[model samples]
Target: RQDPTEEIQNKREEDLNKKKKKSAPKSSYSSVLIDKDQEPTQSVI
Candidate 1:
């Protein structure tokens, strides 16, 4: 019973949010990347 158009709209919104996050300032973005890098190393231990 789900509407296909509504699902498409939700996907579009998610894409817009991802784009906005990518456009964020470099300092915060770098921190996010660093956290991601550390997570894998921590898991290996």
Candidate 2:
């Protein structure tokens, strides 16, 4: 039988890599946005 544990680990790693790639751009965008008008929004939040 195939080893399911290894398969699961591979899938989890793939998912984590995809998440990091997706978040990378979003984090950069937020940093740039806040730098423009962050103090007002930050205090409101």
Candidate 3:
């Protein structure tokens, strides 16, 4: 019999990795915004 649990765990890990890749850019964007908030003059000056 195949070990379905291993396959399921692998699939979950793959999904989590995909989510992290997709969200990584978003977090970078938010960080830029946060920095802008802290240094609006630098960003707009």
Candidate 4:
């Protein structure tokens, strides 16, 4: 039988992963910033 606490933790982690995938996560920030730097129009408001 699975321990309830471990199962709940795993489920919570899975939900977080799903949310990260659905939204743009900051882990991609540096690479995204580098790409954005190539085009400055967006940076300048």
RMSD of each: 6.4, 9.1, 8.9, 8.6
Q: Considering summed lDDT, which 10 consecutive residues are worst modelled in model 2?
A: 36-45
Question: On residues 1-45, what C-alpha lDDT tens digit does candidate 4 reach at each position?
Answer: 999999999999999978876786654454565776675333422
TM-scores of the models, in the given order? 0.50, 0.49, 0.49, 0.52
Using TM-score, rank the candidates from best to worst: 4, 1, 3, 2
lDDT of each: 0.70, 0.71, 0.72, 0.70
lDDT of 2 by residue, 1-45 (tens): 759998999999999878876879666556666778655343321
- How does model 3 score by TM-score? 0.49
Off by over 4 Å in 3: 25-45
Q: 11, model 3: CA deviation in Å?
A: 0.2
Q: Which is the winner by TM-score between candidate 1 and candidate 3?
A: 1
Candidate 2, position 2, lDDT = 57
| Backbone clash tally (model 2) | 0
What is the model-wide C-alpha lDDT for candidate 3?
0.72
Provide the lowest-lDDT 10-residue window in model 4. Answer: 36-45
- Give the number of the best model, judged by TM-score: 4
| Model 1 Cα shift for residue 8 (angstroms) | 0.2
Candidate 2 stretches greater than 4 Å from native: 25-45
How many clashes show up per model? 0, 0, 0, 0
TM-score quality measure for candidate 1? 0.50
The best candidate in terms of lDDT: 3
